[model samples]
Target: MMNYKIFIWMLIVPFVINGQNKISGNHSTQNLTCSTCHSCDIPTKENPCIKVCPRESMIRIDQPVTDAPKIFVINKIRETDIYSPVKFSHLAHAEMSGLAGGCRTCHHYNPPGNVIGCSDCHESSRKRTDISKPDLKGAYHQQCMNCHRAWSGSTDCTVCHELKGKEKSQTSVVSNNKKRIHPEIKTPDKISFAAKTKQGKLVTFYHNEHINLFSLECSDCHSNESCIKCHSTNKTASTKTISEKIKHKKCSSCHNTESNCSSCHSNSEAGGFNHKSVTGFDLSKFHSKLDCARCHTSKSGFKGLNNECKTCHGTWTLENFKHKSTGLVLDETHSELDCENCHKELSYSKPVCEDCHDDKSYPNNLPGKRAK
Candidate 1:
């Protein structure tokens, strides 16, 4: 009986082996073998499977990495030493980008993939992949300011950087609850914002007074968007020098030469002050050859017939009604000279007889004589 049983067990085990092998043979080579059949689709500790998955199913299984850090560099000078560090702000800026969609909106990557580490191209020292490596400071300012400029709103220096001597966090918005602790005190009404011009002229502009009296929309002088709309990035600006960037176009639109003058000259008592409460001057002939400020003096408030001739052609008496014919007085032969000759410096000043009269003597030939 034992011999019969062993023989039967040998035959049965062979049959089981053949059955398992048959099952394995029927499936694709990339899929399960007999021993692995049941565990086929599952990923495991020892043997992971990429085995015969659909594209979408692969994505579901592999799910690409998110929350990767976008990194760059910035160079800041501390105690006369410059540090170029690999600054990574994955958390804070990711929230902003998620709302804006994705990384390509602000950052550019080469040989693209879902990767975010800056080391793909930039070095640990914050150096670029190629010979044209941008320094860390240049990289940051270019990226940040370009995005900032593309966004629709006012762009001023204060928007990103603090004014020369202020803290970055100092300019942040304060909540009402936080304000209640100390309760910011209102500034006293008498406090003024007057300042002296580069030319040593005092200019006083009243902020509260204009708000209280004129009922002026803040946009009246400023653009519809805000104060910087006209003065800053949106407009085409040119200056005598970089320091003089506040071109008068910003102010002249609201208070042209006429209105700026009316601020004071409208109330002054001076003859031929036939100052039209005009919009601006329509310069013609000789007047066109004069400097804008020649008649628009700080003392003159920028208007009036400041045409006392002496205002421009100083001290030479117009043989009373002398220029009435040419409508400009040629008191001395100096007055008879070409308009551009004396005003050649291209700044507004009196057309002096001595400007061209090399032989002319001062206080005799011309009063208030200026050497050419």
Candidate 2:
């Protein structure tokens, strides 16, 4: 009877201790099981067994750069240390992050509400029992050093921290960084790459055309890009070791990088994308304002589309079709007529008036007045 009572107490004590570690605030209300955040069912303060930051599944809340403070004086770690608190330029980094992954690049475990700081999750004390995760000081260094090392190729202590005796006051540092902002990123219209391929030497990329004409966001092509790609001190030496697969990874999303090498790579510098010249379908007149996805619905490639108005418009007749929008307002006689009466060919470039009257032709004979 004594041994059985001792066994019951052992089970009850663990339950009581585990109950104390219950999540508070909005997280408590969430319908998440223990498995969502913790790997072990019985998580104690000493061994929480918390999973790594689930970036893919986490609900991230992103705010504009204007909403955040310009500079943050990082004095949380070791207040009595020799080095003064690092004055971090938040606005400048935020603006630069917009080109790639944005806030989620650093704030990996963000929830739905306001963006929380690193100290909220990462333990501040280095002497803490949670050996699995990095402390706040380690977390700060990890995030900053990763990018700085890539671009500058050095992680010297002086790069961020000034000596205690030489450093200015925190107030002065804040005042100086208050007005600091990242410079406007100048986009190139076109860039010509000299490739080592046997088929073609020059590969011209219309940089502005992809952004303005194709309506692609910067993140679409530039996701997961390191600072070294653009800001590397030795660009040639840094990129020389990169694999061919990594080089063509961005282009392979939209283009066939395997077989159609000549399409992008040519002996001479290639010109910008021309709808009329390449696809034989002139988009300059009617389809200039449309997005690329509007016509190219296929997930694969943009090859299957033929030059037919009805293929996209889907059987436009007298009732539903508006001829006035096409720059020609049809007359009473032409308005009553079917689309096939005027547009005999699938191309639908010009009206065929010869079908009704042999003497009549488009532009010369009036079907209707040109829309003002």
**All candidates' TM-scores?**
0.22, 0.79
Give residue 271's lDDT in candidate 2 (0 to 100). 83
Model 1, range 110-208, lDDT digits (tens) per residue? 222244333333333444343354544455556666655655344665554434344333223223213323222242223222223433233334455
Q: Candidate 1, overall lDDT?
A: 0.41
Every model: Cα RMSD to truth: 27.1, 4.2
Q: Write the per-residue lDDT of candidate 2 for residues 1-372, one digit (tens) a residue.
A: 999999999999978767756877767766677778788867778777878875356667657768988778787887537777788998888878876688887887787567989998888889987777799999999999888887888978877799888987767777666655656778889999887778798889999989987778888887776677788778676656667687788888888889989888999988899998888889998889898889988866565587887779876767987888889898898898877778877777777888889998878988988999
Q: What is the C-alpha lDDT of each candidate?
A: 0.41, 0.81
Error of 1 at 372 (Å): 99
Task: Highest TM-score: give the candidate number.
Answer: 2
Q: Which stretches of candidate 2 lie over 4 Å from their true place?
A: 1-41, 51-67, 108-116, 153-159, 165-172, 239-241, 297-306, 370-372
Please list the residue runs of candidate 1 whose C-alpha ends up more than 4 Å from where it truly belongs after superposition.
Answer: 1-92, 98-101, 110-114, 118-130, 152-158, 162-165, 168-372
